[model samples]
Target: MAVDTTPAAPSHPEGGDSGGEAVRPLLSGAPAEEEGEEEELDVRYAPYARRDAYGVMGRGPLSPAQVARLVLAAAFLLPLRLVAGVFLVVAYYLVCRICTLFVDGLEEGRPRLQGWRREAVLRAGRGLSRAMLFVFGFYWIPMSDRSVPNAEDVHQDQSAELERPGAIVSNHVSYVDVLYHMSASSPSFVAKNSVSKLPLIGLISKCLGCIFVQRESKGSDSKGVSGAVTERVQEVSQDNNSPMVLLFPEGTTTNGDYLLPFKTGAFLARAPVQPVILRYPYKRFSPAWDSMDGARHVFLLLCQVANYIEVVHLPIYYPSEQEKDDPRLYANNVRKLLAIEGNLTLSNLGLAEKRVYHAALNGNSPRALHQKDD
Candidate 1:
């Protein structure tokens, strides 16, 4: 029987796949070949073979010494890390609760803690978040700030009217990305609505003034979220004291090796944004959140004796006249810059391709899912 090597159609939603570019298919596996025929697979699809993004499955089986090391780490380090991590989290939650006390309308409108209360929360949050990362074995983080000075400073042209940096945009790789950002700059994030209901995190997220949205909704609900983000971006640009809004233009996590197509919501306001790039250089297990479950990722991360992270802070990106008018152009241009500077491959795949890859990896048919919709 001839093997079917045809690529499945990507099922991306509107506003998800930017630029309407043709996305390379996310292949689950290579087709079977005849007895003596050598199979040649494209290197691009190597990341998708294991059904998870970032090719954790492709890392192959562990060596005997590696297994012994993991065993020892699991026996000793895991317990200490767990206890310390939990303690730090609970302590931080108490601090947030106290800081938010007597402050009304926090649960209602856009929560912005002012004066001493804001300072208290930001300081405590940053300290505790760093402690938590330390407990997880991120002892030291090396950061590179390659950002250029503001155009206004370089050129004495008041007529230019360059926008101030309103938001910090970065590619999402793992949940750990939030901790680093919190410690670096306590900026508000764009998070899922469900995150607001999570036990310890929900309250903390609200205190950080996280903009919540339903990720699954594609109708007017999404548009409302976009408008809210734009308004917040504008507010940040105008108010020097407002917390910088942090947005992940990719809208989802990847393996940290590829940059996905960006969603235009972050660029809708056309405000200047500080682009940040985060990388996890690991020898054994990767810290990227692409295909791993939260529990397993955390457990493995703690099991390791040490972990490494590199953060690159690029210069503030101000949109040009044409880019300001076209949000897509602005988003794509930023994505391209990140890809080149970060040495990450540019992928046309978006959230939809990720879902399809996940489903196929787990023994489900993506075509069947699409068939039901049809």
Candidate 2:
């Protein structure tokens, strides 16, 4: 039988090939691929409540010697992690205060941030993010030293007025994706409106000028929030000096092995998008928030001495006629590219479906689930 040559759409996380037989390619700028199909990646996407889908964020479990080393390392770092956490909180407050002071001075006429004030905010955000990630035992390793290029260098067709990327979209896996992105570029984000109320984290996010999406708010109210996202993107895209905005279209976290359907909110902005792929590669502790309790996931990472993550930044995706005409295609194309570059399988399940599946797994089902193909 002649082998099938066409690339099929990436598979669902539940029924997809592993892309490789649990292979842990050496750390590099690109996703390491195997000779052929990855071992059948049978992992399922579920809430952290279920503990089965998150297989060690690598090929398999760690060796006894490796486990011993990790334990010893954790023991040696516990005190430092505690002290660093406290110091970071204080340091982050200072970063926010400095940005706010500058912003207050610059807000004379244009409500939108621009000029050197924006750069100061972005730089401060990145600095604080680096500190946070370090204290959390995670490292943000960019795939390449070439940072997000000026729109002129990477995608020139962008008109002088609207070329700079207003949106940086990425695949969401662990809860730490935001940390990694900020460490690379101080981009604002489209996050849940409720996030703005979450103590220090919320306060800092607001200071960073993040646009919050009301995921639970339904009907015209939610639509209004979505509209706000587009308006915000539009207002900021024309200015080269504005801070880049970032969002996770996946909207939900998945194991590093596959992608969930992307939400079109980011694409709705109709602005150029830069896709960044985040993969948490680990030998024992899976950085994925899937199937493990949220508290447990955080505690596990904190107890570990250090963890490594691969941050793959792909070329920016400029909107073509077709993409602009159909945001769904735009979102899918970007999602597809991230999956291919990250060596992850793709799925059609959006965050809603994932939530439904979680309920199903827990022996509960929605009374009338109206699933959308988009």
Candidate 3:
């Protein structure tokens, strides 16, 4: 039988008077491609995300809010550093006095005991210095990276030729270089004697087996630095510690994009001179610059300073046994090695083909301090 094909009564577009309404698209009034494009172009924000368009490492341009907050924070914290510095100095002096008395007592009628007690006092000083550094590190400085080599690796290279202690030479990028080396390895420093007069900081340096030389004053004073280095190597051997001395060959801080030629004194330290290359993620604002005036510059830096601080200990170099006595040639080879490893170009960081003495290196020069120093 032929079935009847008849249409039902028409319903309204909105399903008026019907049991259920017609289904509509979840996203209405936009084509699929258009919807996708809109989603792709959306700018998302996360709380505390780093500000964009700034240098990855150095402080970038700041907004008014950032500047205001930075000022307020500095006003709150500057006095604290001052107070801490003063307190540390007083306490360190007292401790030194007590040790001196004990050493004097030990020396009475027992000459050999005097030497032992002297070393013990020095050891205490080194420990205190390290403690101070830890305290300093906890300040608003946010370190991005500070990884050391595996203990196994540090040992393997140092052990290759155990005839004498090896020297580690690096570019002196900042005062933080000292702390960085201390944190990674216990090595004697090749430093200038002027550092010994700096109150609390000077005390810490002395404790760290720092060989202080008069960079300008010659004869005995100059010889003292090298002599101390040799003595330190002997001390390390007696203690059965890693054979290494930390040497800042550049003798000063730089932008860090280009390494300054080394000061050859470091090569005179007994050993196979190992070139230790320390690099921050950004060459401009590593904590190494922390000692620069320590007030105004730090104030500007703490206020949204570099995005991060990174220290990389590059390869260890062992100069041929022949070059140990000839420091200049030793330094030249180490510099050449670093140049090759860095693969730096003149325009790499907008640096000139040759380094020129900028006012920054001069102690009396007006610094890039944000606030005027009266």
Candidate 4:
């Protein structure tokens, strides 16, 4: 049998597709060794390839048609979004209030709560997160992969000493990642230290057991965080419901096109680690934070009718003999595994470098809003 080898040219209306993401080839310049092998290469990394060269916030000027769409969307959604934002903030505050009273140690200098009181707090946090997601039109698409091959199910790992997720390492991109992860795992995050000072947000984050870290922090600050992560991971006992510590190893956000270099912080712990991947698919507005101001990003996201998030939770990785001894190697190995599974290509640049790149492109620092306060 002879197969048609000619490629079919794509035909479209004046406007191209806008529903699903359009994936492009990440690999180029390689000569095809054999027929059909080029296609295999294209499809390999296609699912996570980037179509635009610039970051999400560098979406450039909108066309007149796009401007009209934005205006219309804002006219219809502005009032509703404001109301929803207020309602969510009030609801979150109330929930945190309840958590402080009932949840042990959440009140500060207190011991851990026993039994139902603790459960009540956990349930409240999860419920609040889901409510926030609902208000923002963020919905998760669930998927998983097992590079470690420890078991078929997450629950099955309960029998092993690993038990429930002790530490979670994920690729960072958006603020919404916290909401999704909190709802899913009830884990404490190793967040940016600035998060601990953001008014009501900071207070609530502490109540939720979040561990905030200073970026590239050194001396006592780094040591303190290292000890904290170690303590949190070690605290995940045999109980399946015990809390897990979460870390975004990229140390900052990207446009979701490339996987940034992984920081070695999370691997400092000896406990079992869980790798998580998150992608927010968008057409109207991207949820990925880049050079955009925070307030503008929030408004853009809230104005959208619907937004989709994709989650991939890989199996819990028990440290091999090599990983057990070397945290740096362990971090790199886990990062490589995630990049392959997530269909993400590794980028040499980290978030700091990206910020500089963004500034050069825009002729202003991405941190301009912050600098303005000075």
Candidate 5:
């Protein structure tokens, strides 16, 4: 049997071969080997000897430490949001007044000039809005799927045609969507006439050139809200310095996972429609409706949100080039794209996309009311 002189297989220390184990080259206190022997040992043992270190810690749910920190942060930041909200209302009113004054003056001097001075003042309101959210810990991740870039990136795109304004529409997910747009593009939204009545926010809307649409008044005078939106779009298109008109075609905010059918009013802007899709990747901690109630939920989420925001500007779709140039058709095209982009998140959560076959169609669903053919 040759005295059983074969070598025994090597043994590893405790912890097995898990990636978290640490390894050493040789036994501690062992004498150094000869150069040839060391080289031979390296060749023989290199592959199996090394061990991987543990990865950096991640926020899984919230640890005790994280919970404690979040609580403390919220305790400080929540009240701050309340105070800031008041300031925002006040700043918005002042800025709106200034803009309104300038517009009135411009109307007198050169009625053809499509300039709104309050946009500059709105910058302050926007800043305050961002700060309030920031103090609460709201974070955003930059998204890359959409061509509708942020204000800075918008300038870099030669094809974007900053001088040629268009109706830029997006799905409504949350009231935060409004703030997000204001921060990134400073575009005016088609707000309800009622929003214009809110103490401070309302006055601001009226003064800042918000296209206030009235549901009941649909005569030729202003098309009420619809007509107002058209005028706003025309004004924006006429100015080389104007912010793109941002509209929530869906007309209301959803829980962010589902997309509603877009209201046709935005499509009626007569300008080419610039379809924009915005998605917030909150991972496991995504702010859901169940997890977060309406307005109060938003305030709470602001404090615990991650530190990044993603705004994916997909390729801009032009209504002028799209088949069936009707606003409803253009809206469908946008809805389709959004459906594709947000399908996984929405469907996984059992949410359905709303349909907008008719402008008169309205539903309680946060998104549009569409039959899901899928």
Candidate 6:
């Protein structure tokens, strides 16, 4: 017998009964909330959202294939990379110690190292920094120079001297960002006072003429770190032989997608700055150091078979008269320029928001959070 197949008549029309409100399709793209209604606050909307900060690591459960890849990497790659990294650090430490052997006044303050000693330290530091990055799996780095009449094209004479920027301002994304900068320019950096006490790295930092800040001290500003930075900027501008001062005006790392409000410390002297933007384009793992613990970051970084960094160098930015009179104006203008050139989102959220996000991720109580100077 043939089966009957026919459509049933709808109890109500598509718009529902004429007097009733229209029925919406289940798959309709319209938002559930009414227009102009205030939406509830969500972690995902925050600039430094925990999900974005953690990248693929926090993206739910891993597949069996992913688990196998990680297992293989840990079993083989991790040990070799760790050993090579340590060896490079120790070898570079010895070189730094030897270079600074006859140099005095480091204990009192930063003293200018000239002649062969300076050359030896700078060259060795650059080479070893690149080597360390290689061990960590950054085999290739692509740098793009977008400076008008690029710094390299300028003649090495009075004109060049006058045009040189006092400092290189870049966004901070990870500790590896330091390695790239060190390899490229061997510039001095502003670091926390605690970093000056770490083994091997402490002496290396001092030898690099790093300016150390007592970040925990309430009177650190009065203690001369800011004054020293201003003086160093001026010094670098005037002295051709002086190392370029590198400052992360953001004062902290982010997820590499947003640019935070820049601190005025790097622009206080009103010296021209060469803005360099660094980006790590990744597939499975993000190279950003936003929310990961140091050890875990290192482990995953080494586990990855390959990684990449793209560097963009912008033209030297000169402060206008108004900016010169106001450091905040100088900083904001540069920040805006960087945001435009680098295609980065300008975020009002700064380090405080980052700290709160991290605290929440780690399950810390709200009261346990403390305000930190940016």
Candidate 2: misplaced stretches above 4 Å? 1-76, 98-120, 139-142, 145-162, 219-221, 356-374
User: How well does model 6 score by local distance difference test?
Assistant: 0.72
Collision count of model 4 = 0
The local lDDT score (0 to 100) that residue 282 gets in candidate 6 is: 66
Off by over 4 Å in 4: 1-59, 102-111, 144-164, 192-199, 213-220, 237-242, 364-374
Residue 272, candidate 5: alpha-carbon lDDT = 55
What candidate 1 gets wrong by more than 4 Å, as runs, is 1-60, 150-162, 216-220, 366-374
Considering only N, C-alpha and C atoms within 3 Å, which residue pairs clash in candidate 4?
none
Tens-digit lDDT track for model 5 on 194-284? 7766776765555445665565555534346676677767777676555567877655444354455556666666565566665544432
lDDT of 1 by residue, 1-374 (tens): 11113432212211122321212223324244421111112232332322221233333345587679879999999999989988988887887788888888667635567888888889988999898889888999999998876656333433356567888999888889999999998999888788888998888888888888887777647688889899989999988888899999888887676777788888999788899999877655567777656777787788879877889999888787788899999998888888788777676666765665556545576567446444
lDDT against the true structure, per candidate, is 0.72, 0.62, 0.45, 0.63, 0.49, 0.72
Tell me the TM-score of model 1: 0.82
Report the lDDT tens digits of candidate 2 across residue range 327-367.
99988888777767777766655566566544533334333
* lDDT score for candidate 4 against the true structure: 0.63
TM-score of each: 0.82, 0.72, 0.55, 0.74, 0.58, 0.81
Candidate 1 weakest ten by summed lDDT? 34-43
Clashing pairs in 2: 18-41, 19-38, 20-38, 20-39, 21-39, 48-291, 48-292, 50-291
lDDT of 5: 0.49
What's the lDDT for candidate 3? 0.45
Off by over 4 Å in 6: 1-45, 50-60, 109-111, 148-163, 364-374
Clash tally, candidates in order: 1, 8, 2, 0, 26, 0
Q: List model 6 lDDT by residue over 1-374, tens digit each.
A: 11112211112211112321122221123256622211111222234432221232243345587679989999999999999999989998898788778788667436568889889889998999999999888999888898775555443443434556889999988899999999988999988888877899988888888888886888786337878899889889888898999999998887676678898888888788889998877666667787668888887789989888889988788666678799998898888888777667666766776675566455453335644322
Worst window of 10 by summed lDDT in candidate 5:
50-59
User: What is the lDDT for 286 in model 6?
Assistant: 64
Q: Which number leads on TM-score?
A: 1
